[model samples]
Target: MTDAILRVTGLHKSFGDHHVLKGIDFSVAAAERVAIIGGSGSGKSTFLRCLNFMELPSLGTVALDGREIGRPAGGDGARYYPEAELCAVRERVGMVFQQFNLFPHMTVLDNVMEGLVTVKGMKRAAARERAAAELEKVGLGAKFDAYPGRLSGGQQQRVAIARALAMEPEILLFDEPTSSLDPELVGEVLRVIRQLADEGRTMLLVTHELGFAYHFATKVIFLADGVFHEVGTPDEVLKQPRQERTRAFLARYTEFGF
Candidate 1:
């Protein structure tokens, strides 16, 4: 039976006086693709970061495969995971950042293989093989030996995707995966993501690509003022959002004849 692969409950994150996320709650079924959209500072990125404990939540719980990750239970009370356990939880949820944070000093192949060998404990030979296959999947097989500086923004981002996939994560979190690419380059990255969804990889995406968000997502979430203002199927959320904030956000991107 299919199950919920990731669950966020009562998530509240704050940075001093600024509340970045306010009681956020969502769940991802196995192999389902979900997209999050909102205006700037709406806390989409912060929500993604909380998944892997990159940013600790002030209060809430994140569960993966039925296990409450990041947070731990003790005899007296509950606490976040220790650093070592937190590291293990992070490996299961791989993330690709908006800026394509690939190592400039490493070739594409090494960048992809680094996590496998270092974090996942795969042998170098085996990691290289996995990295190669991932690169090929992202249409970067020919660019394996190319350095980050030598490839286009789209190519570099593809390498970053490959690097995340090489870990064989159960869930992939993407923060504005194509936001930094040129207009012409956006299609390539989005196409790769479409292929991933076709293959049934669970994914959570935060993006401004409304067209892709509507077409590619099984579920759509609209965040506003650090809260999920709406959540529903693509047709419901994108085509007919019930909230005024969501309608307003979409209006800003609408093109109309003068």
Candidate 2:
């Protein structure tokens, strides 16, 4: 953990009266692929979003590459991060949400290029080149000129992946990237993500595809009611969990080989 690429300590998040995440601590070393699994309302998405300051945590600190982000505000003791600081963290931590979240009006290539040009401030031509390269990596180079509306759900998600990769993030966060895709399309997106894992890309993924997680993760964490119920290697956590909560959860995924 001392050499962790991304680390969280005492992480907590509350939405007004509802506490989504509570006192969670986690860290991933460079090139580690972490798979987080849990039932709905287990704070999985909230926890992932908090890492990038998208859904600000009510407490705790997140660090990237040994540098902690945010600071305590004087009065209430809640963490406060400046917009500039958050922007920089985002550039380092790329995220893909459950939904494709693509721009219907923009071509696939333009959608991928936007972050590079606007946020990274790269020259237009350079951004275009990088975006094209990333798209190619996701096997969507042929779809560059198509709009999100014109592509299948799987292809749209691939475009989202290309956009995230174009930023060259130190780590990638995937929040159920295939959740919205049809069953037939899920495999295509999983294949691309699997390829990234094979390449040793650092990633944290929240997914229900237990079979894929069994094969894809270096570490598997089981979250329950905002806490890590169990954490270990895929075989230990998924196949031979130490906690009753984790066992019950895995039982429901019997067909998935979890």
Q: TM-score for every candidate vs. truth? A: 0.94, 0.97
Q: Report the lDDT tens digits of candidate 1 across residue range 153-245.
A: 999888999999988888999999999999999999999999999999999999999999998999999998899999999999988889888
Q: Which numbered prediction scores highest in lDDT against the true structure?
A: 2
Residue-level error in angstroms, candidate 2, position 82: 0.4
- Per-model lDDT: 0.89, 0.91
Listed per candidate, the RMSD to the true structure in angstroms reads 2.2, 1.6
Please give, for residues 131-220, the per-residue lDDT of candidate 2 as tens digits.
999999999878879989988999999999999999999899999999999999999999999999999999999999998999999999
Clashing pairs in 1: none
